[model samples]
Each structure stands twice: as structure tokens, then as C-alpha cells.
Target: MPEINSRQKTAIAAGQKVLNSVNGTPKCLVFTSPAAAAWAQNDTLAAGQKIPAGSRILSNCAVSCGALGASVTFDLGLRHFVTGAEVDLDGIASNVASATAGTYAANNGVLVAGGVDSVTTVDTEPVLTLEAANPTDDIQIRVEIWYLPPG
Candidate 1:
């Protein structure tokens, strides 16, 4: 077997940190609807991993308008089931003028504890919420969250 170089060794160490949960990991929540109304929750994280306070949440939203002259406005964020408080990540508004297809995309990030560096006790398994103005319109939303485990 060949010997590993210094740079390769460093890369291996970084990967190990992520595998050990020292570094943050990526989690994805996807919601799709032909016509969606009302607030909906995405699938929760796996049993071992829970979102803690001060964890950074990155959001990306995409919307596809089906009908001409149709529009949809929606907010995507994390909602703490216990407190019933939500943290908004991104809002997407799209309008289709003509019969041609149209799409909207946006990106943003937010810390779980409202910019506070310290962790809060209320932090728990967070569910992604999609609040839509026009839920009857065709749209699909996907939110990705990267977070470090809470100590």
C-alpha cells in the first residue's frame, strides 16, 4: 500500500470528525404538493440526532407555477413542537404570467436561538413548516439544515 501525504491525512481527519458527529452534518427535508393548503410538517430527524438551540439552519426554496397567471407565496422555517415558536428560514413568491412554465428559488440561513450564541433549553427535534398564501397552487419546497449536535 502507498503512504498517505500530509494533505490527504488532514482530509481524512476532517471526514472522521464528521463521522463522529464532532463537525456538523447535513439533513434534508422535502415537501411536494400538486396543490397544498394549510401548514405541513416535514419528516423529523432520525432518532439519535436532534436539532439543538443555536444550530444554523440553511434553507432553499423552489416553486413551480402550474397555471398561467397563478401565484404562490410561502414561508419555510423550523417550528419547535413544545413551545410552538417558529424560526423563518426563507420565503418564496412566484407568479407565472404566461402559459410557459415558471420557477422561483431563494436561499437563506438562520440560527436556532435567534442569533444568540448560547444554547437554549427549549431546543428539541424541529419540524419544518411550510406556510403558504396560496396552497391550492402547484409547488414543491425543499429545505436543507446543517447543524452541530448540542452538548
Candidate 2:
């Protein structure tokens, strides 16, 4: 018998199949939220210890007051003995708008936490999809909308 997938599962499967077709082989965007500064940490690392230049990273803060948003700075460090590197940023994503009253776009490529957002005006080489919130500290996210590898 042929297997049947539910609507939601079907949607996800279709999305994954499409992404897998891309030339660069897309990776899922990851998000992290913190209730306090102490909770935020650069614990995750890029797979395979290497990422190309045209790659991108997006980040945002989540808050319940004053349109609070998340921000991050990234940098790369090289281990003396391990021979691996890290990514560093001074101000990767910060002060992104957030919605307070109703359900809002969480991580759509076109929208930020709040209605205010940033788009890839041009085919910039490296882009990082950031996080968006519904105005609560209970959640933190990293959004990966869609990626088309560089030609």
C-alpha cells in the first residue's frame, strides 16, 4: 500500500525536498533564546568546521516590553592545538521589532519579530536568518527561511 502523509507532514516533506534540491545543500537555521544574559552562550558550532564566505547568520532578541528584541555579535577563533576556527560578530542582530498584541510572523523571511524587518534587497553572498518573537521571554528562535546557494 502507498503511504499517505497528513497535510502538515506533507507540507514539511515538500519543503525539505525542495531545499535538498539546491546546489549548496541547505542547512536548517537555528535559534536560541535567553531569559537573561547569562543564558545566552555560543555553544553551537558550524558543522564540518568550515562554512563558505557567502553564508549568513541572523539573530534577534525577544522581549515582552518596549518592542524588545534579541541581538548578537559573532566572531571566529582558532584553536591553537585543535586547528579549528570559530565565528565572531560584534553586532550580528539586535533590537529587532517584536509584536505585542497578537500572533505575528515568528520567522518568515520577509518579516521580523515585529512588522519592521529586513529583506535581502540584493543577492548578497552571505545571509543569516534571525529570530523573531511574539513578545515573551519564554521563547527564543533562529529562523532559516530559504537558501539558494551561490552560483
- The numbered model that scores best in lDDT is 1
lDDT, model 1: 0.38
Clashing pairs in 1: none
Candidates' RMSD to native: 9.3, 13.0
How do the residues 1-151 of candidate 2 rate in per-residue lDDT, one tens digit apiece?
Answer: 9988865477677774322222355544333334443222333222223223343223232222222334432222112123332132212333234333222222322223234323222222222222333223343433332333333
Residue-wise lDDT of candidate 1 within 1-151, one digit each (tens)?
A: 9976664368777783322233455444344443453322322222122466644444334434343222323333445545555433222212212233455443332333333332324454433333323233343333333444433
Model 1 TM-score relative to the real fold: 0.40
TM values, all candidates: 0.40, 0.26
| lDDT (Cα atoms) of all candidates against the true structure | 0.38, 0.31
**Model 2 TM-score, 2 decimals:** 0.26
Model 1: per-residue Cα lDDT at residue 92:
21
Model 1 residue runs over 4 Å out of place are 1-22, 31-50, 59-69, 89-106, 109-121, 124-133, 137-148
